[model samples]
Target chain A: MAGRATPWLIGLTLVLMAAGLVGGLWLAPPDYQMGDGFRIIYIHVPSALLSMVVFAVMAVASAVGLIWRIRMAHAVTAAAAPIGAAFTFIALVTGALWGKPMWGTYWVWDARLTSELILLFLYFGYLALVHAFPDRRTGDQAGAILAIVGAVDLPIIHFSVQWWTTLHQGATLKLSGTPMPVSMLWPLLVMMLAFLCYFAWLLMVRLRAEILRREYRARWVEKI
Target chain B: MDSWHEFWTMGGYARFVWPAYGVAFVVLLGSGWAAHRGLRRALARVASRVRGGRR
Candidate 1:
């Protein structure tokens, strides 16, 4: 399905990411409250958002694979697991870096933070389970179940700031209204789009390889 | 030059700011490269099968 569009997607992602870097690191002005430290929001928000989005993708694909017994669906779940883990790790690390100066600690038991951490662990567990079984089908089924269950944490993580008095800040650019000035907001939005595209590029490339791997023994594998 | 210096300094939050961005850079680039490598490995196997026949 991804075919030749993969290269073009990668190129576009690179361009968008570079533009995001410039917009974030240079064009966007410093925060009045957090000062330059708040620039971390550019990376933090995008990676954080992407982590959840990746998990949602993995969970949905896992469910489809389990329900319909689709080989390609399982392949998608397998390919997305590690990438989702990577994104989650990025989010946690960047969040910690941003936290130290603002919150007086690198980590805390805040609802948002803890839930996001659990999300990372869920990704890890899913990846481990997928490869654990000697029989690949059993492994995929087990991982899919776990992914579906863990997806309950996504909304918990998202709403934690509102539900609890966490060290993490509430949404800065809500659909209702943004507290941010145009300069800061635009870069953050660009960075988020860039990261989303980055995930898309990664997923397409990975799924291609995954599909090939899963179908390697099939007769159709030779023709492609 | 002064404003540029201020920008880099992150208004004195440079320590946190730079590391945050730096780690992000390493992770994103590394993951993308890894995915590309995996794709190559998968494709290379396909090409190899044509020459040597399936294992």
Candidate 2:
């Protein structure tokens, strides 16, 4: 099933990403205040959003694996960790780049920035814990527990801008609609969708790999 | 042609803007490549293991 779906997912991701980039870079008007520097938000916001979303996914998958002893659920947690970490890294680097022009610094020890950085570390911790155990089952269980525990950071990361005075700005895209013009907003929306598709594609690929590794001795694996 | 140059300049913040996009592109592409490579390696390992077990 995954084998058939992977190509379609990759194709969709590429198309959407290209469209999003063209729209953001050319069609969208520059910000009144930040000018073209604001274009970084096209990628930064999507990466930031995905970093949290992927962690939430990992936490939920970990919980499911713990409760039901589902190996596939654990595999999902494993598959998502490195991808989530990558997104978090992108979010930080792009954010720093955005900050230097707008905020006049590459980084600040502010609430929003700090919490997001913590998220990157949490991903690292989960990956390390999972691999540290000699036994695969023990490793999965330990990693799942760590993932569940680390989920507390998600809400903190989300509300940090509101809860504290920070150089980092509040959410531009909100459920209540944004003050941004339609021209700029549409491309961001497209980019967000593209990132989601990219994540799904990567997840499917990694999950397949994780499953194969775990089940290499099984009869089904031999058939594949 | 000058218009294209202006687009690339990104309104004088080209240094900041382009690098941000560049980093995102590299990280996303790298991760995708890594995931694909991992899948291929796993497949190869499984194939060898299965053959060995049968023999």
Q: Which candidate is the best by TM-score?
A: 2
Over the stretch B14-34, how does candidate 1's per-residue lDDT look in tens digits? 999898888988998999899
Question: What RMSD does each model have against the real structure?
Answer: 1.7, 1.2
Interface RMSD of each: 1.7, 1.7
Question: lDDT, candidate 2, residue A21?
Answer: 94
* Model 1 iRMS: 1.7
lDDT of 2 by residue, A126-201 (tens): 9999999999999999999999999999999999999989899999888997899999999999999999999999
Candidate 1 at residue A14, lDDT?
A: 82
C-alpha RMSD over true interface residues, model 2: 1.7
Inter-residue clash pairs, candidate 1: none
Give all TM-scores, in the order shown: 0.95, 0.98
What value does DockQ give for candidate 1? 0.70
Q: Chain A in model 1: its TM-score?
A: 0.96
Q: Which ten residues in a row have the lowest lDDT in candidate 2 chain A?
A: A215-224
Task: Name the regions of candidate 1 deviating beyond 4 angstroms.
Answer: none
